[model samples]
Every structure is written in C-alpha cells, then in structure tokens.
Target: MLGAVVAVNLLDAGYAPYRGLFAVNIALVLGLWLVLPWSRGHRGRRLASPAFLVATFALGLTGSAGTHVPLTLLAIANVAFVFGMRMAAAILAGQAALMSAIPLAVGRPMADVLREVGFLVVFAAFVLGMVASVLRARQLAERVRELTVAQERGRMAAEMHDSIGHHLTVIKMGLENAERFRDRRPEAAWDEVRQAKELTAAALADARRWVRALRPLALDGHLGSAALERLADSFSGTGVAVSFDVTGTERLLGPDTELVLYRVLQEGLTNALRHAGARFVRGSLAFEKGKVVLVVADDGKGHGQGRGFGLSSLAERVEALGGTLSSGNAARGFELRAELPA
Candidate 1:
C-alpha cells in the first residue's frame, strides 16, 4: 500500500519541475532496499534501521504536500519490530516534526505544513497497527508449536513406560522367583527362568517400537479384540486369571481407536500384576451407536495412588480425540474406562 501511494505521487505536476530530485529519490530507494531491509537480522538492524530512517527523511524533502511522507512507513515498522512500540512511537513523533519542519521553514503555508504532518501521522498509525497484528499472530503460532512438541514428548514418554516398562517389571519378578526356587524347587526355577528369557525378548522388541514412536508391533495385523486377548494371555502365566469379552457386534475400528483399547488393557493388566496382588482381571470392549467404550476391571484391592505416567498419557490422548476417560473405584473393583467415537 505504501509503495502504491508513493508511486501515485510521482504523477504530480509540481514534481515534474524538479526532475533532478527524481533521480536522487530513485538512488535512495535502491540503496534502502538493497542494503537496509529488516531481513538483515538484529545484528545489523541496530545500525541499518536508523540509516534507513535518515535516507527516508531525505526522500521526504524532495516534494511538497508530504508526497514522500508515507515512505517512512517501512522504517517505522522495522523499528517497532526490532526495538519495540515505545521507540516506534517516538520515531513517529520525530518524523512528524521533521516532515512539518521542512515545508514550514521554506515559507510554505500553514495548510501545507499541517498536510505534511497529517500524512505522516496517518501512515504511521497504519504501519503500527499492521506491525502489531503481525507480531501477535507470530506469537500465537509459536505458542501452538511449543504445545505440540510438549504433547508429543509426553506421549512418547508414556510409550516408553508402557511399551517397555511393563515387561521389565514382569521380567524382574520372574527372575526373583527363579532365584528364590533355585535350590528348593529346581524344576520350578527352570520354568521361571525360561519365562523371564521370553519376556526379555519381548521387552527388547517393545524398546525398538518406542524408539520408532509407533503403536506396538503386536497390533500390526490384529484388530482390537485379538490384541486384547493376546495381551491378557501374556499375563496369564503370571498366575492371573485374565478374561476378555466383547459385547455388541464386532466392527472394524480405526488404528488409533484399536490402539487405545489395547493400551487400556495392557496398562490395567500391568497394574494388576504389579500392585493389585489380585488373581483375576476382566476386560470388555463395547460397540454401540456411534461410539465404542472399553473397560478394564480387576478384582484387586484398590490402591489410592493414581500417578502413573501411562494413565496420564492416556488421559491426554483421550481428551485430544474428544473422548472421555474415567478411572477410580467401581462397584466391583478398580476400573479404568475410556469411551470414544467409533
């Protein structure tokens, strides 16, 4: 807009009388654009911005009725972006005085002096508003980028905890049991050692999945129901009676939805093995009109602690998808429930 306005003023008949000034203005414009744009970064901006203003002031002197006053718009915006609005406002005042001073001292009429100052004020106001809006939008975009990074970090952290942490816990227990029975029950000790070795291999695979930041490979071809059954069966060797049942007709679900169901069961069974000291855990996935609900309930005695990282990750994931997650003591036992759109 400033470029168009400045270009239109070149058509003024009065400026034709001073064609020599046109060449100087052209040189000034070329120099400013080439050597003093704000894209030079802050290191050079301190000196370049002021130099830009000085050249713009010289440009304003080339004509009357403040024909070149709008040229200061770029300099004002640059200073505002680098230094701040307070300094920009001061620069606006100085430009207004300087624009008015030239015409007034040259014996120009009061009307022309006011016109020069008025043009500077109007253009300054416009540039300041534009600069402010641009800054605000930039800040908001940066904030959103930061939040996205943090969310992904939290999700990845949870992935590492659930994917690898659960298996490690079971492996540790199995190893302890193997050591405990090494002398008393030789056959039982060998059996536990074998289970620990199997779990160690599974945990290594999960670690690879965590590094890649994806859903568990076990869910690659299996649907939600099959994945839950496999997860429950894995923990069956730990002396826990695990049961999984799906109500309503089974339907195909998105990968994300299936992953959520599988994670809930994995986390619940893990907590059962680690803290519940219970013998039974039941999981249910219900498909109804427009939505699916997954519930994992264990007959374990409730522990008041709920600060697990996996649960927090699940809460955020569920909330982002406009789903609901609720976990606490249920009528039967401890229950973790999640409902999402199908």
Candidate 2:
C-alpha cells in the first residue's frame, strides 16, 4: 500500500502513469520473490531469483530514470541483486555504473546528473554497510546459540558422570570386597551385598535428578517469593549454600522475563558448582533502578581458564534478554553478575 501511494504520488508529480505502474509492479514482484522457499539457503536459487528481479527492476528504472524512478533505485536494486546472488554482485555493480551514467548519453547536463550519481553512491554504500552489519550480527548470534546447546548437553552428561558413574564405581568396589571375603566371612560378604543394593537405590535417585534437570521446569505466573524459595530448596542437598534474595515485592513478571531470569540463574549456579570448585554459592535476584539484577557468586576458584558450556549457555541467555553477564574474581572469590531490564 505504501508503494502504491508512492507510485501515485510520483504520477501526480508529473511522472507518467505507465512508468509509475511499472515501478510498483517491480517492487511488488521483488518482494514476493524474496519470500520464496528457494531464497532461504539454496545459493543457486537465490542467484537466479535476484538476477530476474534486478533485470526487471533495471528495465523499469531505466524507462523512467529522470522522472519518478531515481538513479538511487537503480543502485539499490543492483546492490540487492549483488548480495542476494553470488555472481550477481559484480554484475549489478557494473550494470549500475552503466545505467547511472545513462544521463550523459541523453544530452543531459553532466553536473545535474552527477548529483544523482553521487547520491546513488552514498545510498548504495550505506545499504551495503547495513547489510554487512546485520549479517555479521546474525552469524555471531547463531554461533552463540550453537555453543549454548552444546554446553547444556555437556553439563547434563557431566552430572550423569559424577552421580551415576560414581555410584557404579562404588558398587564395583563393593563387589570386589565381597568376592575376596566370600568364604572367610560370609556375613561380611552379605553386608557388602546389602551395601551394593543401597548404592543401587542412591544411583537410581541420582538418575531421576539428572533426568529432572534435563526437563524444562514450567514456571508459575505468580513469580512470588515462594517460587524462588522452592528453587533454592531444590539445591539444598547439593553441598552448596544456596540463597534467594528478592528486593522488589513479589509480582507477576511477564512470562518471557521470568523464564529468561530462571534459566540465567540455573545456568549460572550450575557453572559455579561444576566448574568453580566452590562448595558454597549464593543466588540473588533483585528488581531495582528499573532493572532486574541477578547475581550468582561462589567462593571457589574463579571461572576455569578454558572455555566451557556453562558460561556459553549463560552468555547466550543473558544476551537474548538484551542483558549482560559479568564474571570476575570478587573480593571473596569468583562471581557472576547478570543484569536484565525489568
């Protein structure tokens, strides 16, 4: 509709109606073609589609260059085709140079035409820069997300290794003890058998906890003190001093913010325990100064010297919320601070 309005305005401004219609049609067709499935990842299809689009756009712009269709439009179409199609970039650049110089062919003043040419160069350069920036940002975000998922899986596996694997190792030791004393001390052997049974039960419980940790928790809308307390309680037996601090009174934080905040805390605490070698950890959440601040600190050795999944996942979650995560050695020890807008 906006394009149609612009086309009509151009016609009212003395450009021919046929030229206005042609320009509108070119814009509409290009928009539709860019949305096609083939445009997503298939390089070949992208190249062909944009080539046709640029060709049609060039025809329309060339037909009404000085009237309604500006020289910048020609440059823009060229740039779009250049980026969207692999080989088309150079082709469009050359085409734009030739077409923008067409005014010189028609006996027009070089100075007047040079003005549009200058604007075209600036506009094309700006668009190209914006496109490059957006593409780079998207690429970085994708890499972060990939690393986040990989880190989650690694954390889950480590938990399994620490819990279930440790239990299995203990059971093997108990079996060896019982076998050595089988004849000499049958009663002692019986005790080892019982110990193995107890170990099996504990291992099963660890397995359940591991599975629960993998499953996502459905958060309540209340976002109350009770919810935070329950989360703290779940980590009570993990040999870590876990705490929850809520400065602002409990109220319903919108679902998106609540979910992101919970995940951030979970990832941060998991990192402190698994990587920081800290026996005691503190988790705090406060709403102040028009922002929600979450801090997870540990008195253990700071973030490991190498990259890990926990930090990656935490960073991804923090960034997704338009927030930031800071990790450094606090006065007592290592600390992670995550801040998000309320």
Candidate 3:
C-alpha cells in the first residue's frame, strides 16, 4: 500500500528527470521483492537490509523536489522492522538530512524542506517505537516457553525417580537376598528370585506407561545400582567378561547426583563396547567419606583425542551437578571416572 502511494505521487508530480525516476522505480521494485517475506529468496533474505537502505536513499534523492516524502518514510519504517531501533534511527536521520539538503541546494523554500523532513522524521520514530515493542514482546514469549519446558522436565524426572526407582530398589534387594541364601535356603531363595522377576516385569510396564505419556525419568539411589548391574550383564552375552564392584557403605544421594553418576557409567561402558573392543571391563561405584566416585575401565585400545556425543553428554550432566568427570588412557586400558559430593 505504501509503495503504491509513493509510486502514484511520483508519477503525478513528474519532478525528477526521466532517468532518475526510472532508477528509483527499479530500486523500489527490487527492494520490495527482497523485503517481502514470501518473495524473498534465501540469499535475498541475507541481503535485504542493505538493499532496502540503498533503495530508500535512492528514492529520497531522486524525488527530493517532489511531494513524495512518503516513499522515504515508508522505507524508514521498513528498515525499523528489519533492524534494531538505534540502527533504524541512524539510517532515518541520515536520509532525512540528505533529502532536506538536496531540496535546499536546488533553491527550494527552506520552510517547505523543513516541514517535509520533520513529518518524515516523526512518522519514522513512531514506526520504530512500535517495532521495538513488538520485538520485546516476542522475546518475552520465547523466554516463557523455555521456562515451561524446563518445569515439565523437572516434574517428569521426579515422577520417574519415585515410581521406577522404588521398583528397582525392590528388585535389587530381592536379588541380593536370593544370592545370599541360594545354597543354604533354596526354597526361600527361589521365592526371592520369583519376586525379583515380578518386579522387573512391573518396571517394564511402568517404563512403557511413562514413555507413552512422554515423560522423562531420572536414575536415583538403588535404581542407579541396578542399572549398573544390568549394564554389566548386557556385555556378558557379547563374550566380554564385565565385572561390577562397589566400595564403602551404601548411601542415598539426590536424584540429580544419582542420575549423573548413572549416565557417566552408561557412557563409559558404551564407549568401551563401541570404541575399545575390550575383552574385559571393570566398573565400580564407591561411597567415600565426603564424596561418591564411579569408574569404568576396559583392557582395550586407549582413549581418543576427541569425545563422542555420549561422553560429551556425560561431561555436561556431571558438570551441571557440580561434579567432575575424567576420561583418559590408563596403564593397561581406557578409564572413565566421575566424582561427586556425597
């Protein structure tokens, strides 16, 4: 609409030379083609700001003596939409000064020039202010969306820790009792084994339910211990002897701390399986006086210079929980370790 108004005014006034009018028309058409969202090609999107600014200046200079200041004002408003308020203001001020000076240099009435420039300046300022407000609102909306997602994730993690972790704790206790009494009290041991099997089935059902609801779960306390045991068992079928050992008394840790430790073990074991090609893997979890420590090592090819996605994710998770993770070549293999406050 603005472009059409400016074009009609330029045609009616017929103040510019034919060549100057032609150049302005070409610039206007090209600028609009690049600036309009639907018409803008990928490369044109990148070049739109500079192209529009040049086109606006050309239109103002060519039609300096005509009653087409509206074209220049429209250009300033378009620039405000593309750039920040300060940049848009600077461009508008420069264009207004040049347009006003061109008319005065040609002996146009000073009062007329001042009136035209003042009108353009005021309208451009209003447009720039409106654009800035819209931009700020958009930024606030985006921040709200980010906070919403984080809250949902925290809630899901808590739910998973409560339900799944409780089930895993039951399974782990049942299995430990079964192992302790297998020879001395076979019947009691068998009962405990059956109960553990049932708990495992229940855990699987809970996992499916949570997955269907699109929720996240965190590893916590007994759940982390069970997960480490299961990870070791998985490698047993691959002809790789995996051993898991724990030192110090068992103690409960925060959900975040447990989850990070579990992830560190998981990533370490995965790297050993995929990259190390080891025949033996050793994993350990230790609860010390003031901290918890986890280590996974494999008698395989040593560590590489670059870390993969899993290792990088483990590092980030541990760091976020105020812990430290290290991975390097050990004397006889590769080792990954993590230490966290108790």
Candidate 4:
C-alpha cells in the first residue's frame, strides 16, 4: 500500500516544475516509512514519525495541493497505528492549517480552502476509526490464543491425574493386600504381588500412551462401553469385583461426552479402591433420551465426601459441556453420577 501511494506521487511529480525537490522529498518519505517501525534498531539518532509526515506534506506541495491529500492522510494513518490517534489528530490538524495557509497565500478563495480543510478532518476521522477496529481485532485474536493454551494445559493435567492416578491407587492397594497376607496365605500373597507387578506394567504403558497422545491408552480404539470394560478389568485382581452394566440401546456419544463419563468412572473407582475399601463397585452407563448418565456406586462405608481436585476438575469439565455431576452417600453406600448430552 505504501508503495502504491509513493508510485502515485512519483507519477504526479513527473509534470511538476520543481521535479528534483519533489523526487528528494519522495525518497525521504519512503525511507522514513520503512525505517520508523524498526527505529529501536537504529540506537541513538533516528528519524521520527513527524519527519515522515513533513516529507509527505512537502512531496504533496511539489505537485497539486489538495489533490495529494491521500499522501498526507497516509502519514496520519502510520501515526495512528504507531503513535496512536492523539498524535495522528495533532499531525492532521497541523497539516490542515498549513495547507490552508499555502492556498490562501496563492490568492485562492477562502471558501475552497475551508472546504478542503473540512474534507481532511473527515478523512482523518475515518482513518482513526479504521485503525481502532484493526487494533481491536488483533487484541481479540491474541486473547483467544492465550485461552486456548491455558485450556490445553488444564486438560492434560486432569487427564494424567485421573488415568495414572487410578493405576497407581490400585497398585498401592494390591501391594498392601500382599503385605497383609504374606505369611498366613503365602500362595494368595504371591498372586497379589504378581497382580501388583502387572498393574505397574499397565501404568507404565498408559504413561507412554499419554506422552504419545492426550487420549487414554485404554480408550485407544474402543467405544464408550468397551472403554468402561477395560477400565473395570484393571481392578480384576484387586478383588473389588467391579461390575459394568449398560442399559438402553447403545448409541454413539461424542468424544467429549465419552471422555467425561470415562473420567467419572475412573475417579470413582480410584476413590473406592484407595479410600472406601469397598468390596464391590457397580458401574452403569445409560443412554437415555438426549443424554447419557454414568453411575458408579460402591458399597463402602457411607461417609459423604466432597469433591477433591480430580472430581472438582471433572465437574468443571462436565459443566462446561452443559452436564451435571453429583456424588454423595446413597442408600447403597457411596454413589457418583455424571450426566452429559449425547
């Protein structure tokens, strides 16, 4: 755009009597426009924006006066972007006054110069408005980028906490069970120790999968139901006797919904194995009218527990997707329920 403006001025200078002066003025304008933005690199002494504006005005005077308002407005535009609207307005106002002076000195009618001054004011207003809009759009784009990065980091943190946290919990429980039965039931204790090693291996594999992709390793190619089954089987040797039941015709839930439900089950099972000491865990995934409800109930000591960090994060995720999460002591024992739109 700057090139096009300078090209027009150079063509207009072609017919002017003081062509040499106009050519020098145009060179100064081009140099200042190109270098002003990178003035920090120049260190000590540098040509400022007013120098560019003055050169542009001088270039305009060497040709036709009012006809080259575009060149002046172009200088004002650069000021609006860099030095802001206040400086741009001051520059435009000053130039308008000088422009009127030149025409009046040449014996032109006062009314014509006034009209030209009015037009310059209007053009300056337009330039300021356009630049303001561009700046706002740039600000909004940068804000969105920042929000996207923060949300991704939060998601990764919650995912590791839920998936790997569950695996570690079960491994810990298995080791504790093995220690309790080491002498009295030597064979049974050996089985628990082996299960603990296997759980360790699975946890390591899941960690590898997490590094490769954000999605859970167990849910790699499985649908919602199969993923729940795989999650339940992870507790098989832990003696929790996890039961996964599905009701209503199975239908495809979007990835977000599926992942939220999976997290609910994971957190609930982890809580039961590590804290509740519950012998039975029943997980139910129900596909209803327009939503799905996943229920994880364990017959542990019925002590009502509030949302910990993992559950709080899950609740936030579900609520962001227009879902609800509820957990408390029910008649069965402790129950956690999450519902989301399918």
Superior candidate under lDDT, 1 versus 4 = 4
Each candidate structure's TM-score, on Cα atoms with residue i matched to residue i, is 0.53, 0.53, 0.52, 0.48
In model 2, the worst 10-residue window by lDDT is 66-75
TM-score of candidate 3 versus the correct structure, residues matched by position: 0.52
Residue 61, candidate 1: alpha-carbon lDDT: 57
Residue-wise lDDT of candidate 3 within 72-169, one digit each (tens)?
Answer: 55555555555556766888778788868888999999999899888877877777777778778867967965774575467557867877899999
Show pairs that collide, candidate 2.
Answer: 82-89
Summarize candidate 1's per-residue lDDT along 223-340 as a digit string, tens digits.
6688777666666666779898889987888766776677667777777766677788988889899899988898888657675666887787777677888888767668888998
- The lDDT for every candidate, in the order shown, is 0.73, 0.64, 0.70, 0.76
Top candidate when judged by lDDT against the true structure: 4
Evaluate model 1: give its lDDT. Answer: 0.73
Of the two candidates 3 and 4, the one with more favorable TM-score, higher being better, is 3
Tens digits of lDDT, candidate 4, 125-153 = 88778878887886796796577447756
* Tens-place lDDT digits, model 2, residues 1-342: 235434454555454646656665566556644643322465545544554445445544534433433433443444443454334355547646875677688878988777766765676666656656666676797796677667668777886888789999999999999999999999999999999999998887667556545644453533544555566567677677877777775456655566567666666666665567788888888877767887878788776464455566667777877888777788876777878776
Order of all candidates by TM-score, from best down to worst?
Answer: 2, 1, 3, 4
Candidate 4 segments whose C-alpha is farther than 4 A from its true place: 1-17, 28-52, 100-109, 186-194, 201-342
Residue 62 of model 3, lDDT score: 57
How many times do residue backbones clash in model 4?
A: 0
